[model samples]
Each structure stands twice: as C-alpha cells, then as structure tokens.
Target chain A: MSLRLQARKLACERDDRWLFRGLDLDIRAGEIVRVEGPNGSGKTTLLKILSGQLADYHGELFWNEAPMRRSRKAFLANLLYLGHSPGVKAALTPLENLAWYQALAGEPDDAAARLEALASVGLVGFEEVPAGQLSAGQQRRVALARLTLIPRPLWVLDEPFTAIDRDGVVALEARLSAHARQGGCVLVTTHHALAASSALRRIRLGQGGDDAGA
Target chain B: MPGPDASPVSEQQAGVACREPREGTAVAVRATLKRDLVLMLRRRSEVLNPLVFFALVITLFPIGISPDPALLASIAPGLLWVAALLAALLSLDSLFRSDFEDGSLEQLLLSPQPLPALVLAKVAVHWLLTGLPLALMAPVLGIMLSLPAGSYAVLALSLALGSASLSLIGAIGAALIVGLSRGGVLLSLLVLPLYIPVLIFGAGAVQAAILGAGVAAHLAILGALLAVALMFAPWAIAASLRISING
Candidate 1:
C-alpha cells in the first residue's frame, strides 16, 4: 500500500512571466507537504499541475514508480482535490452538497453518515438551508465536511483554511494530522501556518529575483 | 502522531480493499445527470427563460413583419426553426458557466469516471430542460405563426431531433469559451456555423410535410445528424473543457 509522488524539474510560465522553474517535489506515505509562496508565485498553479488538472507546464511526474499519465484513472481515484472555491452550489443545501460529493467520489449512498459528517462540521441546523443563505465561513465549512466523509489517500487542497475561524482551523489541523497518522499523504497550499504536531515539509516558490519590474 | 511504519500492512490493505468496488459507469452518469438536473431545478428561472424567449421571439415576428397569414405561414418553417435555434443558444452560455464559477467543473474533471460520459450527461440534462421544452412548445408557436396544418407534427418532431444535435454541438462551443469572461457573442459565432446543416434539414422536414411530399428523408437526415453528434460531440466537448480549464 506504499505510495510515492515525485516531480522533477518542473517549470511554468503564465502571461509572459515565469512563475517558477526548476521546481521539484517528493512525497511518500504518511507525509504532509505545504507549498508556501508569495502572491502570484504560482502556488495554485503548482497544485493544479500536481493534481493533473493543468498540463501546460513542463515537467515529469511519477506516482508509485510509474509515470502519472500511464494510470490516470487509478491515480485520480485515490486523490481528492479542493480548490480555492468551496465548490458549494448556492441553490443546494449542505446535505445535498455533501451527497453529491460522495456520489462523485464513487462512494455508496449513506444518508446517515452524511448527516453525521455535516453535524461534525458544525452544520447541524443548517443542513437543509440553501448554501446561498449561509455565511462565507459556513459555506467553507460545508466544503470542509468532505474531509470526514471520504477516505482518499492523496489530498491536494488549495487554501483549505480560507474564511475559517480559529476554532475551525484547529479542528482542520487535527483532521489533517489524523489523516497523516493513518498513513495517508496530503499536499496542501495555505497562507495560514499549520499548527500540527506532525512533521511538515515545505516548498517555497518564486524565491529568485524573477520579478524586477511591474 | 504515529510514524509512517506504525500502521500494519494487513490493516492498510484492508482499507484499500474496502474502497475497491466503486459505482460503475452507468451509476456515475446517472449521478452527474441527477445532480445537474437537481441544481437546475432549484434555479427554475434558468429553465424557463429560454422557453419564454422562444415564444416571445415567435410572437414578435408576426407583429414586426406583417399580419398577413399567407406570408406568416410561408415563412413559419424557417422562422420557427431559427427562433428555436436561437433559444437553445440562449441557454448554451450557462451550460457550463455556473458549474465553472462554483468550481464543480473541476471536481467533474477530477472524477475517475470517463470524462466523455460525464460530459454527455451534462449535455443530456441541458437538452432535456431547454431543447426538449422548446420542441414541445413549437407547435403552440406554430399555431401563432399560422403554420400549415399538415406540418405541425413534423415541426415538433424535427425540432425534437434537431435540437438534440444542436445541444451536443453547441456544448462544444460552450466548453471552448467557458473560461472567457465575455463569451456570449463568441459562443453564437462559433456555434451558428455548425448549426446550418441541422437548420436546413429541420425546416426542410416541415416544408416537405406541408407540400404532402415524403418527409421521411429530411427527418432521417436530422436523426442521422443527431446520431453522429452523439457519437463524436462528447469527445470534442470533453477535450474543449480540458483546454478551457487548463488555460
């Protein structure tokens, strides 16, 4: 069940500007890697590349000693990605959002478990309310509920802490650490410093003097 | 926290074994179709806007051009088809916009299910809500336009078949420009050219039926176009989506 993700000499350019070049990363089972970078430093772009969502970059990625492209389905099935947006449909309720997430992940129907997961996220009374009516943080919480609902080995989360309060951050850190303790790997990008006891690896982008003018 | 070596191999394998039996392709398709339908259902205006636009556009042509029944009936076949095509186009911009805005499109892209199958599901829902309704409502608009009596059924039938192809083909254009901020005009520009064949055959079906000729040929051609679009449009749409998102 051992899993490894490795990238070599990755490079990306956007709008005639070099965001990052000569970037490399490696992650194994039971690890949490945080990508740190300044604004416009391509942190989200890097995460997208790692998740196979973006292909314009120049790089080679290997998963479990095989080319990532060779077994995309197998790789994606074991991966969970949460982008900057909460991905909640405003027209839908929290329960419906979680249900759709579960279904898309190929998980079986379990209404009882979904309700418990929503409740654990502090959405007890807001399950049936339209997400458009919820606060920004509450909508973010609705997206965070997926952490407890699905059990994928690799998680590529982009700013999972945005709009979340202090207590929410603490609970989320605990959840990430728990995932690592269970031999799962997470590749996350967030501005907020994680307060987990587990060892955290860091990848800093745009360190060189690449942006001199404008 | 436990180190990497703390978990026993047997327990870890058990966890892997637990998640192996995923839902099949059919289930995945049904889930996507159901999710989109449910979301669109909640936003009732999205479904009704195009239908209303179709009826309004049909109603305007008579008052705008002339009240003469002979002129209206003579042009009704082309007018109805054109109006229906424009109505379908009205909804195409939104087929992927809301999902892309809310980030659900990224989830759909990341899903392990076949991309083409999932995209086909989305197009199916679009046609079901927009294209199918416009087809069913065409006869009423036809009556308003004084369409020849013999061609009423053919008008609806041709629209039902033709709009399926329109939705499928229009989806490709929609997917291509979904990332752009001002894609409405460009969507029409890209899709309208491809719609010519469907338009000719669809109106031709009604025209042939009005003249008491064998309309089977025109209807068959429309069906064939749908069959071809069904086979190939999904892949084109899936590719266009990838390009749009990755850009």
Candidate 2:
C-alpha cells in the first residue's frame, strides 16, 4: 500500500517525433489518473514508459524512490499493463487464456476462483469458446478478466474501453473504481469520458507535455 | 538459475516461512517438450506441410535432372538436405508470426517463466513440427534419390540434428524480422547463410558414409553445431524478440 509512481522532466519520442517533453507527474496509492489527449498524442507511449515496457526515453522516471532504469523488472512485475490490444490468444478458450495469463503474472491463486472471476466479468457461458470467435467487446472482456485473479497494485491501460460495448464499459468502470477504492492506483488513457462514481483524476497531454487541460 | 516455482514473490518480500520450489533446467526442458508436442498435435497439417514440400522438391529433382541411378545417387544427399533446409526455412515465418500478430507473444513476454525458456519451448515446437518430420521423411525420399541404405542412417541423423540447429538459429532471425513488412524474404536472406554450417556437415555426413569413410566426424560436427545453437540461440532470440516487440 505504499507504492508511488512519479516522473520528472520525462520526455519521449516515437518514430523520431517528439511525442511529449519535459513532463512531470506524481500518483500515490488511492489515486486514479486518466490521461486524455488527441489522436497520436502519445497517451499510449507515456503509459508504456510508465509501465516500464518502453525504456529508451530521456529524463527520469521513478518508482517509489529508486530510478526506474535500475529496478525495471521489479517495477514491471508489480504493474499490470493492458494495451490497446487485449493481448488474448485467439486459439485458446477464455478460461484457458486466463489460466495461462494468471500463471504468466506469477499469481498462484486457485483456478476455480479464477473461473469465478471470469464469471464476474460476465464471461461465464462463453468461457469455453476460443477468443477468436468472440466479438470484439467479448474479447476485451476476456482480457479484462485478468483483474479478477491477479493482485498487482498498479494498472496501466491504454484505450482500455475502445471496443467494449456500453454495458461492458460501465462494468469495467465499476471494476476500476473498486480497484482504486481498495488502495490500488490506475493510469489509463481514454477518449470517452468516465462516469463520476470513481474518484478518477485527470491528466491531459497537450501540444507541449502533460498538464492540467481538457 | 532458479525454477519458476522458486521465483520470489516480490523483490523485498523475502524471508517468508515457506521455501519456494525449484524446477531445474531439466524440468523446464521437459515442460517445453510437452508443450511443443501438444502444439504440434493441434497443428498437425502445419507440421506435415514442410515434409510434403521436401518430398515434392526431391520428386522434382529426378524429372528436372538425369533419371540415371548412379548420377542421382552421387548428388542425392546434398540435394535432399538442401531441399529440407529450404523447406524448414519456408515455415520459419509461422514460428512467431501468428503469436505476435494475435497478441499471444506479448502475454508470453509477460510470463513469470523466463522468456528464454518459453522461446526454447517455441523453437522446440518449431523443430518438432517442421524439422523433425523432414528428418523422418528424408530416408523415404533418399531412396528416390538412389541414396544407399548404408548412407540413409547418416542422412537421417544429420538432418535430425542439423534441422534442429536451423530452427534454433532461425528463431533469432524470425524474431528480429517478425514485425517488419516483407519479413519472410528478408528472414531467408538473414538466416540462409547462418544455416550453411549445418547444411555442409549434414550432407557431408551422408556423403562420407557413401564413400565408405568414417561418417562419425561429420555427424559430430553437426551435433556440435546443434549443441552450440541449443546453448545460445534461446537467449539471443529472446532478447531480439523483446527488442522487436518493444520497438
């Protein structure tokens, strides 16, 4: 419950274009920060940098008090990063996918409870179907199903609600809210405005860098 | 290295009561073999397709070249081995392409199990599917090429060992080129040279056996190549894959 994600003078580039520069941000436990920006404004890149997935950026990112460069794997192990792609294997059933993902995350929790978590995401009846056959929204639901079993404290999501239907989006918001209420921290990027039930903070990536706009 | 079960829960959360289980390299290797076997079974056609291609290429050689038995026998080992190498190369694209495209590769990268272990499992699977079947089929095709029975064992053994080396080495190439446009042809260009050592020794083994010379030396070379690839390719390929995905 003592996790802290902070960045100072962080700058990033994608394909030689400066996406963001000289950005500073801080989020402690119990804060849900939302990153909103225009298309191709580097919301995803910033999330990846924060999640330790992309590390070739300039300036500093600190997890707790240590430099992110020194403790990357340790940092990544505690962060759950869900990109625009749900990252579910299409050939495997939803249940099978979740089982493997839970193992990948090094969670040793009960598989039965994992299945129950899938059910919690309203994927009970479709658990046996391969994800390739599922609709886009359903596939997303299966990906989000990981939240039920894994216990990582930080969730970094990029456009997490993209393909989810209206009802699915609402359900996901509730899950994010519950996660934050339980002393977890979330950093997400989205185009759609999230409802106010969750105490979600906001950070908008403008033409310059991350600041309090939009 | 510690086993998957022995991995610490957290960097700082050590000194817990229970001792973590340690799965050694042997268990990791066995688990890898099992997973590869299952994947091969599920994709049976993909496994056999390369063998069929190998057989087809050998079949064409007889019609494309002289049908005389002596002439065909003289070059059969090298021809069949080259065709098999190319066939293996043709299917290398499928090794990580599907998984990468479907997003499964990302999940694998995130796995607590070492990425190298998972990559070794994948390379093993590729060898089982594409390389092993070609080795098994080479003996049957060798007869059509008029390869002597005495040399057939050498051919099969060399191919079995050598094609495995190809898969391991090719994995690095495949991973490096996974996300690029026109990657398949580029991959061939990158890996085909690396495959030459395996080919030279594999075909040379059978050729030496045909000459009534000691084929053991040639077979030993192929085995050494396989061993080297087995030791290094997994780590290199895993690193290249991470770089490619992150890029």
Candidate 3:
C-alpha cells in the first residue's frame, strides 16, 4: 500500500501552550489510524492542518508526495472531514441535506443514491423530517450518511462515535474497516473502544497529559 | 471545467491515477444558492422581519417627524434610503451566523471549489431574499412619505441596484464577526461607515430624479460602486471566514 499522507516536523501551539512540537505522522492506504488525546490536546487542530482548514501551525503536509498548498484542490477533493458538530442543516430534511453536500462535492445529484445512503444510515422513514426535529444521535447519523454518499480517499473524522447508539456504533466500526480494506485511509479521534478493529493503528498525543501538569 | 464525473485533477505529472471526483463550480454554486434559499424560506420569520422593519421605520417618519406632504417629500429621499439600508443591515447578522454555528461553514471552506465563488453564491441568495424584497416594498412606503410622482420608479430602481452592493459589503462584516456571540452591535459599527458612499449616491439618485435633473450621474455612480463591491467583497468575506473559523 502506498502512503497517502505524510506530516513532517509538525509544531503547533494553541493559547501559548505547545500541543506538540516536531511531531511526524504517516498513513498508508488500507489503514484505520486512530488519534487518541484528551480535551484541548489539539487532535482536531492536527486534523485541520492535514485537511487544509487551519494554517496556524508549522508543518509540511504532503498528499501523495506533493506539498498540500501546491496541491490543495486535489487534496481537498479527496478529503472527507466530519467535525464535532454534525454539519447538518437543522431546517433541511435528511434528503435535502445529503443532496446539497453531494452537489457541493461536485457530484451529480442522484435521488436514488441519496435515499439509499440515508437508508443504510438507518434514517429510512425519517427522510423528509427536518433535521432539527431529529435526535442528537440521528443528527449525527445524517452526517455519517455522507460517507456512503460519496467515495473519497482520506476520511478525517472527529469523534464519530459520540451519541451514536450501540447498533450504529457497531455498524460504523464495520464501515471504517470496510473503507480501509478498500484502500482508503481513516484518521479518526474517538474514545469509543474500537475493539473489533484489527486494522486499527493508534497514535496518542502525549503533550495533552504533560501540559496538564506544567 | 470538468463535468459531473470530474476526472481526478492531479497537479502531479503523468501516470498518477487519482480518484477524486468533483463537480464544476457552477454546480457547487447552484447547490449553495438552492440550499440557502430553502433554509431562509423555512425560517420565514427571519426573512420577513427586515421588510417589516423597513415598513415600520418608514411608517414612523410621518408621525415622528411631520405629516405635511410638502415637508415629507422634501426629506423622503434620505429617509427612505436610510430605512432600507438599516433593514438590509438587520438581516446581515444572521447571514453567516447559522452556518458558522452548525459547522456547515467549515465544510464550505473545505470544498474543492474556490471559496470566493461559493461565498458569492450565498451573497446572491441573501440579496434575492433581503435586498430584492426591500426594493420592491419601498414604493408602497414611498407613497406614505409623499415621494414625488415620477421618482417612485427611480426609488425602486435605485434601491434594487444599490442594495445589491449593500448585501455584498454588509456580508464582509457579517463574516468577520460570525464567531462572536454579540456581533449584532459590532456588525453595525464595522459596516455603517463603509455604507456611507452607497447611502449618499442611493439617496442622491432619487433626489436628482425627483427634481427632473436627470439622475444618470447619481445612478451611474451607484452602479460603479456596485461594480467595485462585486469585484472585491467576496474575496474579503472568504478570507474573514477562514480567519474566524481558524481562530
């Protein structure tokens, strides 16, 4: 498997506290790498830097061996990022939400594909219900449904297991492994024990615990 | 531009089989426009509040100032312009607030499409919902203010053209303060000064048209301001959003 993303000398500090200095990272295809760290440990920050969202850091990120800035368009095109908030519009129905996301990703708006994705995420009967009316776990599912809607190489998910029910968690864990087995890389941050994941490779952020004592 | 099945565009040279499929900018722009329109439409109260404010402020002038037709006509141009400008400003706070709060703005930032183009599409929808309605509703309120006979059309035309620039300019301030909880007051402080030239020319257009002095100069200047704003504000708004999101 080829290396999809590599970070060299990544030094990031937030609020005058060094989250990490000279950190290096590498992820190859068919690997589900988990980022473990406490609150404010800069797990999200590191993901943002790699995904090309946050630039308040010192690092060189290469996608397929090309500098991220020089190839930002292609990098973003292949990246699928799921943040803490579900990224679902409260007013729009699940169908509308997924359709808009697909369109923004520059995919053809296929009603069948969106419906099928929603069903796979277990939002079958509630397709037309406004997302604001859905429960928190359901709302997160609406965001997770994006995974099935489009095919992307790199998935940077922050706390994907939060508020998810047992069934949803089991299904999601399986999906992550399935995706990695298909030659996609999954970089996730979660406290949920991925006990069933044989494909998991974890990198814990040590600065989070050290900075607390300082 | 690549079609629906956008072949993975790799900056790297030959033999790289990348599989990132992207839709064209036009499609992305259309989706953003449609999604925003639907969102605003569903929140009908937010959409209508500005127009109601416009009418209420215009309604207050006769009772608060003077009911005399002659007196009202003399001051109507400036009053109408100022009221419309405030109403447009009232809607600006919510423009990026919801997107920022719900994390949709982050997704927008991460899109393969250029940020400025996507931002422009959103501002277009804002203009359509807020600016266009205010312009159309002004003529009715103009009658209340005893605006001159022929200048009613000019009032609508001036506002329709000028408010486009207002939405564009106001959006930059909206984006800058989107991360703040109490941005409504600061938004006005940041945007009001920039709105001066637009207010001057917009109000001036109707006043000139009312006098039958040929409003071409005033209207032309408003158009020029709109042109300048159109060219620059989207990029500014995009940059501000990135800063706000990162911080």
The superposed Cα distance between candidate 3 and the true structure at residue A201, in angstroms, equals 1.2
TM-score of 3: 0.94
**Residue runs of model 1 more than 4 Å from their true location after superposition:** A196-198, A208-214, B1-23
lDDT at A123, model 3? 89
Q: List candidate 2 segments past 4 Å from native.
A: A208-214, B1-40
Query: Candidate 1, residues A1-214: lDDT per residue as tens digits?
Result: 4778888878888888778877777788788898888988888998999999999988798877789899677788788899999899999999988888888888787899788778767888999999999999999999888866776888899999999888888777777776776778888999998865555778778654332210
DockQ of 2: 0.22
lDDT of 3 by residue, B146-188 (tens): 9989999889999999999999999999999999999899999
Model 2, position B227, has a per-residue lDDT of 89
Candidate 2 or 1, higher TM-score: 1
Q: Clashing residue pairs, candidate 2?
A: none
B-chain TM-scores per prediction: 0.92, 0.86, 0.92
The second chain of candidate 3 has a TM-score of 0.92
**TM-scores of all predicted structures:** 0.94, 0.90, 0.94
